[model samples]
Target chain A: MHKTLWREIKKEKNYLLAGKPVPRLLILNAGSRNHLIRCFLKSWAEQGEIIVSDSYPLAPSLYEDCRSFIIPFYKHKNYTEAILDLCEKQKVTGVLSLIDPDLSILSELKTEFASAGILAFISEEWIVKATFDKWEMFKVFEANHIPTVKSWADLSEFLNDVKNGKAGYPIMVKPREGSGSRGLHYIESEETLISVWNNAIEPMLIQRWIEGRELGADLYFDIYSGELIEFFIKEKLKMRAGETDKSVSLRDEKAENLLKRLSRNLALYGPIDVDLFITAHDDYLISEINPRFGGGYPHAYACEADYPGLILQNMQGKHLTEQKIKWQSGHYMMKFFDMVFIDDKTRRNAGEEIKQQEEN
Target chain B: MHKTLWREIKKEKNYLLAGKPVPRLLILNAGSRNHLIRCFLKSWAEQGEIIVSDSYPLAPSLYEDCRSFIIPFYKHKNYTEAILDLCEKQKVTGVLSLIDPDLSILSELKTEFASAGILAFISEEWIVKATFDKWEMFKVFEANHIPTVKSWADLSEFLNDVKNGKAGYPIMVKPREGSGSRGLHYIESEETLISVWNNAIEPMLIQRWIEGRELGADLYFDIYSGELIEFFIKEKLKMRAGETDKSVSLRDEKAENLLKRLSRNLALYGPIDVDLFITAHDDYLISEINPRFGGGYPHAYACEADYPGLILQNMQGKHLTEQKIKWQSGHYMMKFFDMVFIDDKTRRNAGEEIKQQEEN
Candidate 1:
């Protein structure tokens, strides 16, 4: 597989040297209205062309320009088949997935693509699995000498350590695959820890919570070449229900250096969100690696970094030139507001009651 | 357009927060691919799913299971139309282009996608034009305090200066839109310069040929935010017919720093190949900016840096993380070899000729 990939790279290089133009790209999405995917899609659009698909009828209308397709049956039934059908029908040049559940299926398909001489860009299955599993990723980081938060997989061992005062309180507990802070709790005492552990059905990883709002850098690396290509840092302001409410782009040379070190140590490829805890010691402890594009991608884009464009270039086997990104260092908040509509009858009743109160 | 883009970013963010799955992406290329685009595609694929377009008809045989289509028309016809038609017919979620001519057209189509909330990435048009045009890009760099080789637009002026001993000979001359060193010549005297200038039909830019072999850096930046993302330095091993015979990837902190300074001064976007001359004084003079993906991207990829992934992540509005790339410093060369087939009769004839010569 590696040899084939290398051959493709060589071919791409030869064609480029020959002054032949590169081909256009197309993106495929199962979910029509995902903000993160949309950001990537937009980035891809900057480079070539795009199309969208939604198995759900009420899919968001944001991707209106992309030819939207309805595949309600494909959602729960045979997603792979559905995708295959789409590929055959649309003459899709490539396929990319943005979610975890799709990884294995994509990996399987990647093998097929490889056999067909079509390039399927699924990460090494082992790497994806290891990174997705927090414990596995930590092991890799530890082996590579990448600094990370102290974590324990077994609750009993963790509790024992805490009882002995080796592990302190105020640690965090959450499911291994959970997204957004779901079912996560801060345990300040043994009793709370036990209670939370009992209530949490999903397997969990325990760690000492890093003190500070989440500050992260999303980095891209070439897995084959082990080269760092681009990076962005964000100070997460508000995270509600596992989503950041407000965040701002920041510049820190130290943070950048640290991330660079970690990327090299991990032999990272693709998008990795390195969670960090800035502590009183003025140091950063690696939290976790979200092995995909993060929600704050727009901040990078708005900052004038065309990361999406970079990815496209890399896949096509081209070199990146030095770029100047215009990052705005100011408060940028993403707040969610809910809209509620009241009927005319309710409005009139409420108005009458207010009027009566005022008259009295 | 910016407002709409923000809205889409927010929407995508919400989806990620809600734990909705993202989609897969596909990248296509005809020749040497864009490193930035490839990196981003890989990044997206790491988290989601990805497929790359195949230029050869037999490529489908290589990548059978993954989604891919053969759009032979893209090679020779209107690339934009071919891409759009493919996207519409295939239900692709997004589109991207990593090369020059495609970027301009993609920028124009970004709005069409935006109106429908379909994610389309388009860098600033003026930036694109300025950076792609070698002469204009140099002008921008100079105006912005970016250091470059002293150049002259008028050949007569340059010749006069050289004849007067104000400038040295063996200068480099190139056409504005020329690629792969085509039509580029080294003129050592006023007579040679005059003859070449008069015969050249295209507007040309002339610069003192720095006494150094070609060395370049593939760098990425957030053009909107002005943040330096990723970079790598490389040395050209050989050149033939305007293409490198062997391009090797290297790591140099000093070169990276110089490229960073240049990027900051230029406020560049997309793919940028900055050529530099390491002077006797240890000062690096900027040669030019490609403003698109260069042919040497595979070297970086071989070194494990995924630049294309970074661009895609940025376009998706995700935060970029810092990644450290560990480069293999041994002499790596991309050598070109041609494959030819001969029938048994031809082989026998060749063998007989050899036998006759030996007998003689």
Candidate 2:
């Protein structure tokens, strides 16, 4: 859906306010073509120019009406240098890294970007690491008395917990650091659990299953003011490819209070997406956090919860007002497929254009 | 999705006002089981009790936590008598019909229900007939100068138009009185048009194909004041079986002004569903209208457009204000499939329960 909807927003030109010229924004690894990326393109375009980068020259991001650059992957030795070069060339005032692997790297290089007078919209290094590692997040939740699904790193410990009547069967065996339901298995019997554990990946966790409705909370914190500016909650109605395919925006006091508390405790700098479950007894249990915009961010954006505006304001050295978070409830979002056609000749021409830029 | 969400609405009960007791409402042909029905069930239940009826005892309507009844089809000899008897027994104060075929029948029987002190929330007979008959509706649109796709009832006339460069190829051959795309076809050549015309049902029309973004408008007229109280427009991004599968709510002054003119011209009482197409040249064309709740009603409801509340107020002898029409824009709705399961034994038991009630 993020494949260059330049025509859709042409009528929106008249609504843009003529403020001080804002600098370009750099969005890293922006070629996956998701709904959240499309929303941000629409929201941020009204404020300032946007620059997107991916590893492939023929990526969808290249087709958008913005500055595009092909850079090395996050694991590459020159990846950080390539991004800094792109930011300098484009005069980027703010840098946002979307994918998971780059969040920690961007957090570590925040100081470098800051030295060049470019604001990095990322959390602190410790917050990024704690949120990405499930075991570390579990410890943080326990310390804050926030209920989370119990887990065991060893099969013997899980069995002992089962024997002690503290946990039950139908538990999940999942990778310690994974997204999109990779290496996830549910086991109900001892024989199945043993077989799965034997073939399981290293650094896996066996977690107790919470049999209830799943919820996602999209929140944001002002890096300068340390105030929670955005808090939107939605109930996940359906899942596909380990992402929320359908969801409904709603108001829940208990869930809202929990997210506010989490914001105060974590002090996350930029956008935050948290996954949790509401048990049969009406208990809110924190499960995980994604430091960037999650798959369900479009639902929040459609409700007029403007996170992109906040990011632009922060880049301009302004605090986001609470008035920006006023949003509607009862909105149900159902996701579907859309397409963009590019002839082979056009793609090859685009590739040649990028090749000339690279050579220059 | 609305299979007795008792826990989700537990917090809403305190907001109910203890005024005069609201009587039970009867919804006819309630087995389609869409999001609008679920919303109405939730909305009306807060004001008073709800009773649903369908031809099948095992319909999805029976599974909802409300009074249920099995009735004969609309064409049955005793259909009117059956509804009247049910209203008398249940002390029903309001009745709403959801299907296309029953709207005219309900409109015809409006006077009978009025005599019995039961309000039938349907438009007048002339309005119902005009909306259902495409040829008549087209004439009405032409009289008002609201653009509509050119159509022809005579094959020779259509061929002459095409030959004279008045129209182009790829026209639509559809049944003159069809719904849900039952006999819809796109003909690009002379031979294909001939073949489709041979197989089409009698009294068919050749409609000009519009290549543009389609929009659905969910509207309501206050029965008490004869005023257009609610209007919500959505750009239909996807459709299934003539139903809006994915849509985004927005405001368009061109479309809104057209709808307002239509409301004043038609003086439509109760709820209305209008379909239009925004042409490639940025022209709005009136397509069709259904005098009952259309498939996209849930999107308006989710935006807090409160059509059900307006209907309830009308039934309660109160006038709806302009404040009820205020709603949020940019709300997106994505519809998907959900299931409500009932075992063989439970279904049989429900059937038996209905049979006992019928015998009584």
Q: What is the TM-score of each candidate's chain B when compared with the real chain B? A: 0.72, 0.89
Compared with the true structure, all predictions reach lDDT values of 0.57, 0.74
Off by over 4 Å in 2: A1-360, B1-21, B163-165, B321-324
Report model 2's TM-score to 2 decimal places: 0.50
For model 2, residues A142-228, the per-residue Cα lDDT tens digits are: 888877888887889888888999878989988888777888888898889989888875778888877998999888888676578
User: What are the C-alpha RMSDs, in order, of all predicted structures?
Assistant: 29.8, 16.5
CAPRI verdict (incorrect, acceptable, medium, high) for model 2: incorrect
Candidate 1 deviant stretches above 4 angstroms: A1-47, A71-77, A223-226, A264-267, A319-328, A331-360, B1-360
Write the residue-wise lDDT of candidate 2 on B236-315 in tens digits. Answer: 87775566766777688899888888755675777789898999989899899898887668778877777877777787
- Give the fraction of reference interface contacts each candidate recovers: 0.00, 0.00
Query: Please, what are the lDDT tens digits per residue for candidate 1 over residues A13-113?
Result: 55344464333333444442244445556776534434445443333321234344443233467667666655554445455555566665665676675
